[model samples]
Target chain A: MSEFQPKIVAFVCNWCTYAGADLTGTSRIKYSPNVRIVRFPCTGRIDYMLLTKAFASGADGIIVSGCHPNDCHYTSGNFYARRRWIVFKKLCDFMGIDTRRIVFSWVSAAEGSKWADIVNTTNEEIIKLGPYDSYHKLSTQDILE
Target chain B: MEEIKKIARELLAENKVQVVLGFEKGTANKVRPAFFTKAEDIDKLIYNEACIHNIALYLKKDTCQHAKGVAITATPNVVRSILQLSAENQITEEKIHIIGITHEGKCAGILDFKAAEEFSKTQPKGLKPEDKALIEKIQAMSLEERFDYWVEAFSPCIKCYACRASCPMCYCGKCNVETNNPQWIPVASHKYGNVEWHMMRAMHLAGRCINCGECNRSCPVDIPLNILSYMLSDFVLDEFDSEAGLNSVFTSALSAYTVVDKENFIK
Candidate 1:
């Protein structure tokens, strides 16, 4: 049987996780190649709606990583993002979204290995969950007519 | 009902307020929002369990905005919405007078914002048992089952937006959904679009929703929409220990955060 390669999307902050992912590349770290990264100025800039858009656009899994608490380049952007994710994660779970498919983590500029680990772990988890056909079918269906 | 009408009449007769916003019997045994401009029109006022509409939403309307002052019949949730609105600087204490009603069908009399705040303190808060039960039931489902449940529930949405229109907190002049220049949310009633719309609605109202349940009551599809906000409200209470409309002094959960705020889930 063929192996399943899950499609993953990573919404990362430019100041931390993005730089960390960049460091992962420069440091010769091998991680899952399945993830497509989208960089924003800060984690707070990553809207919850955009996360839904990622799923709608066929992403089987999502990784939202940013600076650690009090480490936001914008001072408190990650702190605010943390609170948002806290509520958003609960909301998603309550609405029946496979929140395990969405990973939240802290990947500082120095944590290239941590970034790689998160990617590999999220990729492995998503692969086990298989294709996100339920959401995929929902996003593609024509309900406006 | 007589007490409410008498107060409305006195408010207009004494020139205390230019209008009194309350509810009246609609054509189909339903209670409809009524605006009383004349002292005689106060006779149309009705206060019953069926008069559950949160009339504070009208305070944002242009007609109400231009009025010199307004006297509003406020249920517990309406009082909370008013307090939240006042805290948000949408309304002022002198501009509107509150006519509070108890859950037991009694009048609490004309109250200033201060008195209303005190009155609201005594009112019971949090989700009703039925709502909590439904939330727990959904929470008990498997992820796949939950997804299908919401899909089936939200699929019938026609993008009518009656929920948003009925919501008191959704008073933004230009909602995110209306900004077509960037087209933030899809205008279609499709499944994905509906889910995004509802999620955004709930997120936007997370800490601010007064648990008025108007959004759910107003949905033409019977989509149990209030459960989302109720869940978020409970989260705000448990995680932040903050309740909306409790007093106007505290910052909303999303707007302000402390260093001590709990975020154990983040690595």
Candidate 2:
């Protein structure tokens, strides 16, 4: 009867966003509980398949966060990731997927406040969008039936 | 084209090469690739203005293993496709021979391994007038509009996989689309499946496609499938200034990296 809380999958780069989330914990920063953080070495390591996988696994929103430009641990990893994300965003748009469900952000290892703010803002946006109905339709529930 | 066939037959009769790969007339004037194993079969090999399909797709098949060498009718895109395949280890340089053809239907010459290597390097200076016009047209559109335009153009796809089947660079035995354990793509021909099929194929070929136009030519529904692949290939070429099928020396665009590559999209 009531609105459902959206599930958010946040793929945070281990060297930057994950550390920033750690810092957020240490700083006692408050944020939405909707997001589940999955860490990667760098955003460049995130496969386009994994983004779709998260949605297929019932995440209403997905966030891919990494170090700010000129701050990648692998020097050019974020640059490669940036170029790939541009194509991925365009592909998502063309697929008729709601682009707002997938968010790309740069949260530095020191940006604990920014990480908390991003999580809260993204969570609020997802809540308004409701459950990811399109992705859910591709779930195992349909396969089982 | 007739002169080229006569020379091919002579070479095969002399046992200079074991196989001659060329086009034969097909239904509705479509040119389908024909393999000539015996010198007598060489009479069937034909080429004309309509020989557009990249016949390189058949060189790596199981049937080609017994052949001493492959002789293909070459266009610029066909040459480019071969170079890319050789570089990727799909076929060896020594296993193939190229018979280059001018647009005017003359056999430029038979380019063996060594000559093919040099020919790719001698890529003509300055962009073709058609390429310049295409680039200008593409550049005039907004990114969102371009995305929308491609989606409409790709709507005719039927998931036949003919495009994938005919591509030289698409040599994987177990393609991503066919994986079933955790199916990467739907098996049906819905709009979502069709769009995803094209997008996934285009993405996989981002840095590898050589603008051969084989995928577009092979499409049954006449989708401008090459535009997506060509756009990505152009992006990779401009960003890294690397040519995909020209030589084996340069690292693939997606596989290798530079510390100075652009990162404007990252916040």
Candidate 3:
């Protein structure tokens, strides 16, 4: 029997985590190959609906990373995004979504090692949690109809 | 009820307001939203426990917009919605005259926006014990169990959007669900669509929901939809120390962020 490998989606800000991931590649940093990264101009641009769509698209886990606090290129986009995540995380937990599968982190363009670490650790955690069948079931049911 | 009618009569006869939005006895023993335009029709106004509909929503209607001013029969939550709406600039304070109703079923008489704000502040701003208990019970369930519970609760949704229509705060001219150029949310009422719609509704109302329970009350399927928004409201209060509808000039927690905002979850 083959060992299960999870499909992960990473929503990263182009100014930070996306550049950090690029740095990771250039630096020859080893990380999990399971993640598929989606770049947005800023974390503030990543809509909450996109996160759910990732799950609906068969992602076993998600990584949402952006600039550190007080470090956004737009001065306050990350701050606004942080506030959004706080409320969004609570809503997800209250609605019984497996919020554990969604990771929130700060990885700047200088933090190549941190970007690799987030992806590798999130991949392992999602592998242990198995397939995200619950959300997938919802998406497949829509197709069946 | 008579006091409400008397005030409605004076407000109309004096030309202080061109219309009075209140509740009246509907067919089938239901008290539904009623709009009184003439002093003679004021007697049709009714106020009771069954007068739970939030008539503040009518103030945004095209007919209500044409009125010189509107006098609305406002419960505590309805008054709160009015304050929140004023803060959002959706409605002007000068255009609304509130007839407040106490929790004890007494008429508080006609109040201007300032008095209405004070009235809402004086009212208890906590979840009802029953709603708190139900939320705690749901929180005690395992993740899989809670997911299944919501899926079952949402399965019966027919996408009528009576919840959105009835919400006083959901006064958007173009709702995200109605936008199809990019189709932010699916139009169908399938499992995913239902959950997304409800989540969007709850999120949009997070700090703004006044816990009027109108959404849940209006749901044809009896889906306890208000609990989600109420829980988010509670979350905003506890985490940000900001409460909606307390002041008409206050900033929303989601729209306004500070350098010192709490964020332990970020790495």
**Which candidate number would show the highest lDDT if scored against the true structure?**
1
Q: Write the per-residue lDDT of candidate 1 for residues A1-145, one digit (tens) a residue.
A: 2299898999999999999999999999999899999999999899998889889889999999999888999999987888899999989988888888899999999999999999998998898899998888877865434
lDDT of 3 by residue, A36-116 (tens): 999999999988988998898899999999999889989999988988999999999988999999999999999999999
User: What's the DockQ for every one of the candidates?
Assistant: 0.67, 0.24, 0.74
Q: Model 2 residue B235 lDDT?
A: 66
lDDT of 2 by residue, B139-227 (tens): 57665465456555665667899999989888888998889887888787654456567878888888888877778777899886676
True contacts kept of each: 0.70, 0.12, 0.75
Q: How large an RMSD does model 1 have? A: 2.0
The residue pairs in collision within model 1 are none
Count of steric clashes across candidates, in order: 0, 0, 0
Predicted candidate 3 versus true structure: per-residue lDDT over B53-74, tens digit per residue: 7777888898789988899988
Residue pairs in steric clash, candidate 3? Answer: none
Number of the candidate with higher lDDT, 1 or 2:
1
Residue B240 local lDDT, model 2: 74
Which candidate leads in TM-score? 3
As a whole number from 0 to 100, the lDDT of residue A91 in candidate 3 is 93
Ranking by DockQ: 3, 1, 2
lDDT winner, 2 or 3 = 3
lDDT score, residue A107, model 2? Answer: 96
The weakest ten consecutive residues by lDDT in model 3 chain B span B50-59
